[model samples]
Target: MNAQTVIVADDHPLFRSALVLALRGLLPDATLHEVDAFDALQRTVESGIDADLVLLDLHMPGARGFSSLLYLRNEHPALPVVIVSGHEEPAIMQRAFDFGASGYIPKSSGLPTLALALRAVLDGEIWQPPQLKEAPAQALEHRELAQRIASLSPQQFRVFMMLAEGRLNKQIAYDIDVTEATVKAHVTAILRKLGLVRRTQAALLAQRLLQAENAALEVPAAEGLPVGEDDDA
Candidate 1:
């Protein structure tokens, strides 16, 4: 029989160890790898580890935000990735889907739910534990926000969204491939267009807009899932 294999990535060693123990108990013969952050996770996968799925942390330092989600999906294509996060902010969760996460489970969810998410993915279905979706937030309008979004240029939009995540100016500059001065200029324009009072306001506006738009959209994965409706493992 083919042995199931999984990898868990988070910077928290103790937490990672606990999950490893639980997963080891649950899956028995399945192989598991634990990674501390994006670099470690990426390198481990690149080192030729055959992972059937990866449980990833979204907000860990160096996680590359949703970009790493895209990266992993891009690289493995068929590999399933279930987000293991402490942050259940709907926008981030939505972003995970946009980047092609197969499942999402909050760290606070008990082991049963985690196991269910893993099983669902293993069974060729995407999973998002219902309990995690109970988080409260004011609803925003998508079509209206899309109309508003038409005002920003592509570069300006990138800066605006990155800044909305509370990323520092330097980080935004680095991410958008512009001068810090250019980022500042873009920020100023974003503020002016949105009629914002401060950078914080702009950030908040961006957050609201992102949520309203439910901007997390699933791109077609670079690879396909396993070719059968059932598995013998």
Candidate 2:
């Protein structure tokens, strides 16, 4: 198998750089790219950069909540998206899932945890570690939404995420190096694919998925799971 390319996007330049450098050990020979905010995230992605995977910040500047995940899905639906966030709120995780994140990892998570999450998604498994939520109704709601959003293509997913982040179509097109007409076309397709009504509904669904996904990462490390920390591959 070829080394998977990975993009890490965040508002903090140093933090994002560190992640890219650190991840090289995880994906040696894997091309890495970094972008600071949602706008740059789109630009980096749409500029013909190649990546088999994306490490996206759920709350990067210019993008809020789970919208980034949605946008990535729309643009690169086949590419697995792993939520890289500083926030560990259960609700936040769930929203990531609702928006269609394949995995979720906290910033505090060490390389072992990051490796597990990344590999889990690449191996075609849901990337959440598992959690017990007190509210079954909330969990059920998220599952319903996840099922709906799961069918989106990467491009549709990216567009959906951006919409949830309160980004305008013009901004998205500019960032992605596409025409405004293309962005509108993508937005329409995203809505149809997710069976959503308004952009607000799509945004709400993204939030729910992200939160639901976050709720699932409560498991301890699995036995025999390879653990790597600060190792440069």
Candidate 3:
């Protein structure tokens, strides 16, 4: 039988390890891949692993609230994603579903609930906390903006993320191994696609979506979970 494939994208080593441990019992024959941030998760999917599901952390580095969720829903429409987040706000959970998350699992959930959530998603069912009521109506303009951002090409998306990170054109060029002119072109395309007038506006938008929490609180190692070696392939 072909092994099932799952990607766990979380930065907390201990919690990620604990997740891996729980997942083993649920998908014993599955190939589990791990990633630390949104960029790594993007690269993994782009490399064509065809993961059955991705367990994503909402506050992971390189991701802003709904930004990564929008990108994944747009770019890999077939892939199922179950958000594994510390944030348990009903509004946040609702937004995840709106952005196409297959499920929302709070970090504090016990192993059995986690397993149940994963099983439901793998069986092609959408799962959110039963306690959460649907969020208030989202603005049409906001929905339109999400679709526009989702339309970005992978390279353009990468460039957009770098711009959000406050990297200069030359710095982005160096990091992505592209020429400065190419980076500039990507920036232009990204701005045009997002219907934005300037890089600062784009950056601010990313900040609002991706960095809602304080930067220092981004990647706390989960307490009481035993640490395990990272699996980044």
**Cα TM-score per model:** 0.58, 0.63, 0.67
Structure candidate 1, residue pairs in collision? 98-217
Runs off by more than 4 Å, candidate 1: 132-233
Q: Name the regions of candidate 2 deviating beyond 4 angstroms.
A: 130-137, 146-233
TM-score between model 2 and native:
0.63
229, model 2: CA deviation in Å? 56
List runs of model 3 lying over 4 Å from the truth.
1-3, 34-50, 60-78, 98-100, 110-116, 131-133, 168-171, 177-181, 213-233
User: Can you rank all candidates by TM-score, best first?
Assistant: 3, 2, 1
Per-residue lDDT for 1-233 in model 3, tens only? 23689999999999989899888877889999999988998899999787899988876787766777777876888999898888877656756775578999988888878878887888899987754645465455665665566677868877767666777777888999999889878877876777765666666566555666222112122343333221000
Residue 15 CA error for candidate 3 (Å)? 3.5
Q: Model 2, 1-233: lDDT tens per residue?
A: 35777788877877887888778888787888777778888887788866778888766776644556766766577778888877776676666676578888878888888778877887878777444144233566455556566667666666766664667777778878888778777777766765554555555555544553353422122343333221111
- Each prediction's RMSD over C-alphas, in Å, is 14.0, 13.4, 10.9
